[model samples]
Target: MGCLSATRSKAIHKIDIPALDWPMARFPRYKYPLEDYVHENQQEDAKCLEETEDLIHKYNAAGKPVAAILVEPIQAEGGDNHASPEFFQGLQQIGKRTGAALLIDEVQTGGGPTGKMWCHEHFDLPEAPDIVTFSKKMLTGGYYFKEEFKPPQGYRIYNTWMGDPSKVIMLEEVIRVIQRDRLLENVNESGDILMKGLTTLQNQYPQHINSTRGRGTFIAFDGTNAAKRDSIVNKLKLQGIHSGGCGDKSVRLRPALIFQPHHANIFLNKLETVLSNL
Candidate 1:
């Protein structure tokens, strides 16, 4: 059996769980605004890539070869952390060299929120990942995989209660709706409004906010600290906006594909009110 391993990225929810004795490499903590910190972010990427390769090698030499490396295209629960396309491409190459299957977890970023069915599509990987997992908006939890990952025996993938097949029926209708309504296009349109509004808010309230980042409508911004973040979320909730916080002090925006430009405007106005009061 291969040794289990994981990345040391800030997937906040993992903090309370008992983890396996696996080697973990740091995820790049890029500085923002991304344009101004290009060179530094590049160096950060290089450093993380090096550490990942080192850990893979270290584990292999220890006789527990890593069989796979799993990652989120955008680290959603991890403060909406993002890595450049170059970073993802590099990671793919490293995984290939190390004989590790690259597994992308698209549970949060999938189903058109990032204006793509799969968030990793934006990375422009040379080829598809060896495995892709999805659930959330997908209507049912499942995965896709390259032939090599398939087990030779039947029942190997069984669970006590197979997920409802009825969900698949709903999933099919959901796909039809997305395509017929051009919801992906709506995602891009709404995303632009939200991103721009967040940027404006950050500029107007730099003391309270910073590090606004995301793609399509899958966005997030960090507060100066956790208390401020919670306060902002609470205020927004009172105003009828149901948003949430993640990764310690970041506020995340996970809107439905049906969310449109006008909806974004309402959200922006409410957000502005909350920030101004703060």
Candidate 2:
């Protein structure tokens, strides 16, 4: 149906057990801080885009046409890799020209984590993506698509459980609380603190960590190696600050939208302590 990273679908997950054989393309990997490596990162984007176009054309010629191209606003599992707005715009144009739907997977970057309800909003596409799939923090899993992408007949995309209606009620309450408390504003505020703190840490421990980057409460940095990254995560957990690692050596921070500046300060302090110990 759509070409997506194999990393997106857990092998153990039920629905993923019978996945289709779709063409896959490599997502770009950018250097950070993004501002400092703009030229190199732009080149990286161009290279990946070229590869994507080649894959589309090659697959079509082979008579196994790709119906959709799926991508994440931030490649969370693949190391928090991000593409520039221009890169995403070019992708949308390519998808349109090739008659393939562009699907933005916001499973990890949505619900205010990226300072937006949907991370794809930051891309400023000419029009909405053909489809947007979401889960994780949304408290449920589902997808939204344009009318043109709708199934031609009923039951084509139907599921027995569909989804739990009770989950919808809970999600509605969660939405209400988010709006009432203005959690999005809180995420932005805490994100600024986290980013600044991480930058400072990177500067202070250049030999141990580097490449600080993120948006809102979703932040990440690279440890010099996988072993060091695991040690840092384990040490942080012992210090009552749970963190996670991705793409071998990258440590990603997934704080709640309600996380405040003070919480960020606490995390930073604990993180610094762990670094000092290391």
Candidate 3:
């Protein structure tokens, strides 16, 4: 059980089923407009990383030496939480020191949502992770490991049909189109617009929304409260602009890579109308 799987959703895991008892380390909860709180955020990162090391030692003392540390580049389902590159780099060191493999789960933050092919790419890891898993936008569910994690013998891990051939073909074409059309560029462009517009809205309607934060088009802002978040999402849906809520009162925006400036403008305008009405 020390070769752990941190795969459960932070929201509903308690109500679902019994889980292995793995100690949870604190994830850095940063303040909104990250640039404004640089020192505080850095300290938060240090605090969380220190706790992670402490947990590893505690688990080791219990005779269950930690074998792996699984994390997300951006904690999407866990309210889209994010940690600094330094935190992740420090985590990799902890894994090395503790002989635990570093596994990064990218099911939600993958496929160029954060203006990067993988969200961790933004982290600037000194080396590749021990294991990286992908799905959803990837159109296939699979994991790739570093050479060391590969099977020692043939057929140790085997799969004939990876997934539906149709999905594979579509995935290939999707990658091609993304490259040919330079959709990542488009994501950055659109994301800039969206973030700027959202920040303005946050300032303009502080009571309705705040804590606007994100990278590229993977954006989110907090509602005044949970009820207010539900109301805002519902109102946006009524206005023909789809939106979603995650992680308490945070409204997460999962715009496609191809989402253009015009689309961002329309969405922002609709959001403004909703906030104004609220």
Using lDDT, give the best candidate's number. Answer: 1
In lDDT terms, how accurate is model 2?
0.86
Model 3 C-alpha lDDT per residue in residues 66-98, reported as the tens digit of each score:
878888888887677878999999999999998
Residue 64, candidate 1: C-alpha displacement in angstroms: 1.4
lDDT of 1: 0.88
What tens digits encode model 2's per-residue C-alpha lDDT throughout 67-100? 8888899999888887888889989988988888
Q: List the residue pairs that clash in candidate 2.
A: none
- lDDT of each candidate versus the true structure: 0.88, 0.86, 0.87
User: C-alpha displacement of 275 in model 3, angstroms?
Assistant: 0.6
Tens-place lDDT per residue, model 1, 171-208, is 99999999999999999999999999999999999988
**Model 1: residues >4 Å from true position, as ranges?**
1-19, 159-164
The most accurate candidate by TM-score is 3
Look at candidate 3 and tell me the lDDT of residue 82.
75
Candidate 1, number of clashes:
0
Better of 1 and 3 by TM-score: 3
